[model samples]
Target: SYKPNIAFYEAHGLKGWQALEKTIAYLNEKCPDHFTIADAKRGDIGNTSSRYAKAFFEELNFDSITVAPYMGKDSIEPFLEYENKHTILLALTSNVGAFDYQTKMIGDQMLYQKVIDISKEWKNSRNLMYVIGATKAEYLADVRKIIPDSFLLVPGVGAQGGSLEKVCEFGMNDQVGLLVNSSRGILYASNGRDFAEAAAKKARELHVQMKKILINY
Candidate 1:
């Protein structure tokens, strides 16, 4: 799977977006079976969200796009309208600031849990997934209780000091419902001429670890 956070490309302006376009095209050509996610974290009003949906799912041809669910169901339903495309809603993020709101208690559950419960009631929710930070691996057990079958896009591994082993141990469902990401760990594996090779090596390490976990499961 390939997840390209749009912010990285946008930082370089037009050239960056072009590079992003090329990257997506290359992935489509070389790994068509792989799922592609545009980690854009977009969400807006109904009309605006529809355009965002069209831009990512139609124009960009991403299999999924990350969205902020703070705007409520109307902002998210537009993305859910697309067939075979997914809307990855932010729940508990890896960043330190997330605790400001995400983990706050509301009645018997945390705010993030309430967000998940509410989002499940939105239309076409079967196409919905959640972004649960790998940094909070212990929280996965409680998260699974709310949505056991949903896939989780987990970031914060490697560079963020998240444990892949702990994430797999608590987050995996019958279908292995986890996508543990290690962006900086793989991307900046080396600064020399053999950068690509170094990145591949890093990826292989994670692959081997995942394989062992899967085998045990």
Candidate 2:
């Protein structure tokens, strides 16, 4: 799967958007079997969210998109309305600032737990996936108790100090439900003419490690 975080493209204005569109188009045409995530972290009021949903799922034709769950069910429903698409909610992020709220105990459950638990009751909740950072792999077991069957997008491996072994150990469901994205490490794998080859080398390294882990499972 290729996750192109729109922020990286949007920083360049119109050309950035065009680049993103062309990128997605190329992927859809050449790598149709691969999943594409519009890592836009969007969630707003109902009407506004509908447009956002269309912009990614229809306009850009992404299979999935990351979203912020801070706005509650109504804000998320617009995205969920899509039949075959996925709405990946922000659960426990890999960032340092996550401790500010996500892990806080709230009436016997953490805030992220509350978000996950409540989300299950929403319309089309079956389409909901989640973001569980690799850096927070220790907490993944507890998260699994709530959404064991749901797919998780696990970032923070490589440059972010997250151990792939730890993430796979605690977060893997029977379906092998994890998408470990290693953008920075792969992108900057080399700063010379061998850059593309180096990035592929890094990705193959992760793939080999993952295959080894799954073999024991």
lDDT of 1 by residue, 1-217 (tens): 8999899999999999899889888988899999999999999999999999998898889999999989999999999999899899999999898899999999999999999999999999999999999999999999999999999999999888999999998999999999889999999999999999999999999999989999999
Q: State every prediction's TM-score relative to the real structure.
A: 0.98, 0.98
At residue 130, candidate 1 shows an lDDT of 98
Q: Per-residue alpha-carbon lDDT of model 2 for 1-217, expressed as tens digits?
A: 9999899999999999999999999999999999999999999999999999999999999999999999999999999999999999999999998999999998989999999999999999999999998999999999999999999999999899899999988999999989998889898899999999999999999989988998999
Worst 10 residues of 1 by lDDT: 20-29
Query: Which parts of model 2 are misplaced by more than 4 Å?
Result: none
